[model samples]
Target: MRRVSVDIGGTFTDCFLAFDGSYVEAKALTTHNNLASGFMDALGNACEQVGKDVETVLSSVDAVRYATTLGTNALIEGTGPKVAILTTAGYESTVPLMRARGYGDGLSEAEQANLPAANRPTPLVPVTRIVGIRERVDYKGEAVLGIDETDVREQIRRLVDEGAQAFVVSLINSVVNPAHEKEVERIILDEFPTHLLGSIPIILGHRVAGRKGEYARTMSAVIDALLHDQMYHGMSSLEMALRKAGYKQPMLLVHNTSGMAQMNSTTSLQTIHSGPVAGLEATNYLSKAFDQPNLIATDMGGTSFDIGLVTADGVKFYDFNPILHRWLVSTPMTYLHTLGAGGGSIARFDRMWNAVEVGPGSAGSDPGPACYGRGGTRPTTTDANLVLGYLDEENYAGGTIKLSRRRAERAIQEHICKPSGMDLIDAAKAIKRKVDHNMAQAIFKEVAVKGYNPKNFVLLSYGGGGPLHACGYSDEIGISRILIPPFSCVFSALGAGNMNQLHIHETSLYMMLYDANLRQVLSDFTEFNRTVVELEAKGREDLRRQGVPDDAIRARVEVDMRYGNQLAQTGIVVPFRRMETAADVITLLDLFSANYATRFGEGSQAPEAGVRINVIRVVSYVEHEQLRLRPSEVRVGTKPVARAQRECHFPKVDGAVSTAVYDASAVAEGMTIDGPALVESPRTTFLVDPGWRLTMGAMGSAWLEKITK
Candidate 1:
């Protein structure tokens, strides 16, 4: 079994190759101008390590899976074409108005609470470009008024005259009846043929989102249309490069829904935050492989720290209407909470507190951290790490790039130490403490908010900066055990390799499961069964289009249900696909009750008012053979010899401690190194702070267990 997977992040491109029984990992700085260059460089590095050429490796791999940030970058940089929205008459302000709570979407709680600092992001489609078509469709699948072709053409021409390069037809309630939206799309395509030079791409809300929210659906289509061009070209260039390197199979793209599918079968909206989601998926696989049923997955990279949860009951948490950046969109995304605290996050003195504060702002890859000698003048967490002697100046990233300790000292002394009136070592320690505190708070909130205790789950830390600081953050949250997974540097790419081919389809409808006021139960199962079958067919067709056989396809059903007059909906995955009897309806209600209780206490079940299912979702997938991971049985081992020594400063301790520096590549399974120690791998460094023991496990995995008193 040979496979290759790559994840393109903002700062680095990571690659993982599994050939027979050997697994290799590599990384390279990302080239934002041409992403394929970074992809090939990382892949070439891994191929060279395996004693194989790029052509031979590409030709021999079973699959080449990719999880890229192209869509995310496109949205962030605003490099997309101008898109115009066409909605029903009297709803021209729908996209511009957003929702009452749209301004707070994707913002931190502190930022959200600051009413005076509230500012909405610039609209992807301004009000001037939004045109209203003369059409109306009721909540039911009934047309109140048919759209006029002349009205549609004139409105479209007006938008094009006003500098609209793309179109989004998001008529109200299109999910219930999409006849008007389809008609508008047909007219636009007819007016501007695809073969012509002046043709523009058209997006329909019904196809992009299968739910019934007016603002969310429209924004989903708008985002899809906005990112279409950049994602297409970026993915195409990667594919062309793969072909040139002797690969003949279809390239699979990892999705934010915790699945993978052919490139042609994906939507741009489904690709946002895909790299982080892939890492979470890999954690899901590791949870089962290592027999740790509950795991908290944390990825600390150069720019961001992402956290996700894997529970013991096998309940997959999903955000059906998650916000993308500042726009609330209707899409099913694997739940992940991200904090802006990472290695390259800038540190500054807070005047209000008269203390050092770590980021929500990053130096990124262009100038990077001050230690990189890349003209970055700002103080960053990386600089603090360097000042504390946690990093090797001449051997960073396997010596691919050299660090400048003098520059790090200058940046920190000028920015943090001088402002806070503290010395250099104290300032660096303060910065480290603040950043770790921020991440610890975020992790605890993400877990506890879901009604789970942080102390019960084992911490699975990975990415470039994870293992280095895992001990600090884990201790703050009362977590005593941490597992640095195998291939920790490129864990997301490894996750991409384990994803199954899958697609999801859903529809919005009003179905009563239980009526408390009337004291009656749902008796008719025809509509429920029909809706399930239709959603299943749509998902099956999507998988079939990607060459998955009918026999190999499997589907899971989920319903978004809520109590009477409640705004929040709880998505419950049902055991059976089709509901043919009242027992099936009762079973769904019971499941929803249990899930809701788990999330909001056992006494919070609210079936007294009424219970209704608002949306029905179907996930169809074809399971592939996963990457086999070797299990670790050794928990204690012989002491390893140190290769060198370094004096490192700690946040909790005074002065400097002489730390044993060991070569991570030389250590075999069943070797233990007691802290304080430094295990330097090719791509990352593991800092074993005082009172923590590092135990080497199989396949480059290690355990960091704190010594209890």
Candidate 2:
């Protein structure tokens, strides 16, 4: 298979190319102005490695898939179009009020606890522009109030006059019945026909999310509309670039659903955090490739630290209504956690702590860190590393950009040293410690909160900054094993290459699985089986449109069920797709109970009260042949070749230690390197801190572990 996958990040555009059996990785500075340029540049770099030009490479590849941070970037920059929302009458404030807890949606617990400082996200659509029409849909899809066409036309006119570039119609309970929403769209099109010069785009809520949450579904439509123009033009321009380069296959866009779909099947909201999701996909593949059952994937990049999990149990984790930036959206996204901690994470004096604090803020690539001498004056993690002699100033980013030691020292001294009354090195050490601990805490929470013990999982670290800090964070969280996977810099791209073409269709329903009041088991499988079949057919139609043979496509059924009226629902991947008998119903109940028991402890199952299935989901996917990362069976004591040596200062150590540095290029799969060393590559630096050892594996894979001897 010849495939190329690229992840457009805030700082770098990473490319992973698989030509036949050989793999190559490349990265270039992200060009926010024209993403295509950076994408081509990174691809060109990969082509050079494979001894082919861009035309030759593109013409030969079977598929070119891309994962991007563009949607999230646009949201953060607030550069999307002026979006207005249209909702059911009296539900005008649904988007504005944000469910009472909207202010704390995407924030950390501490930020959420500070009620005095609570504030909602900047409105996606101004309340004034959010004019409502008289329409209502009951939870059961019954239209209680008819859509007033005249009112809809008037509201659209008012919104257009009020400068609404795009429209979102999110009537309450529209997912159950979208007739009112569909009518509103038809009315909107009538008023602003395609022939009109001022014709605007419209987004319906039901088509965006099938779940039954008013505020979240509304935001999903709003965000999708807001990001439409940008994503459309950007994606179109990128595809054009690919076509121009002799690539004939349609470019596959990775979705946060942990799947890849052609541009025609993709959505703007699904593109958000896709890069990180692709990284998780790669972790999943690695988990299988290396036979590591439980693994914690950590991607520490220039602006964010993402954490995800992969276990051998085949139990998938999903965030049904996850907060994107500050707005909760009802998209069934693969469970992934991201923190604003990275190499460019700024460090400053925390008056409350009387010590340095690392970020939830970043410098990004533009004017990146003080060490880059790119007009950034703040002390950042990169600067701290530079000051501590971990980075090679002359060869950072393959010497694409020069680093200034003076700037790093000045930034840390002026900002961190004076404020914290610590020396420059000490302050840098403190910054490193704080950032590592912060990441460790996040990992612990993400794993333990889901009832998984941290010690049971091995740490799989990737990205430019991941290996640099993996040892520190792993040690803090009691994880003794860390694997820096192949092409760590472009690991997300690797994931994109391995992802299956998948589509997910789900619906919200309130069905009683066990009727406690009536004391009857759900014997009539008509409704339940019918819904599951419908969802499967929808997914099947999608894959069929994508040119997959019906036989090649597979479907996995899942039911979101809860005990009694509990808010938290347990997602059960139904072992049996259809329940035609009482025994089948019992089997599903047992499965849900066992899964729930494992998650919330054995005694937490209270199904004696009743059981209900809230949502039915069907995942139709076409699995692709994956890249295999075979483990080496070499002896562990193989001596490493010394490429160079450097004096590096580590935290809590009195003085600088003369550490042996190895050239990563010369390290073979069977080679092993000892502690207090640096594994230098052109694109990244692997810091093997004191009391650790690294065992090199195939495909640039390496393991950093605590030195027991």
Task: Work out candidate 1's RMSD over C-alphas.
Answer: 1.3
Clashes of each: 0, 0
Candidate 1 residues 1-709, lDDT tens each? 8999999987889999998777899999888899999999999999999899999999988899999998988887787999999999999988777776687787777898895689988889989899888988898879988988999999988999999998999998889888898899899999999999968988899888999889999999999999998988899999999999999999999999999899879999999999999999999999989999999999999889999999999988898888888899998899998878889999999989887899888897778999898889999999999999999998999999899999999999999878789999999999999999999999999999888999999999999999999999999999999999989999999999999998888899899899998988899888888988988898888899988899999999989999887987899888897887888888888988888888778999888979999999999999988987776887658888899989999999999999999999877888998889999998999999899998999899999999953
- Model 2, global lDDT: 0.88
The TM-score between candidate 2 and the true structure equals: 0.97
Query: Weakest 10 consecutive residues, lDDT, candidate 2?
Result: 628-637
Q: Which residue ranges in model 2 land beyond 4 Å of their true spot? A: none
Clashes by residue pair, model 2: none
Give me the runs in candidate 1 sitting further than 4 Å from their true place.
Answer: none
lDDT of 2 by residue, 92-172 (tens): 888888898788888778888896697777887888888878888787789888988888888888888899889898888
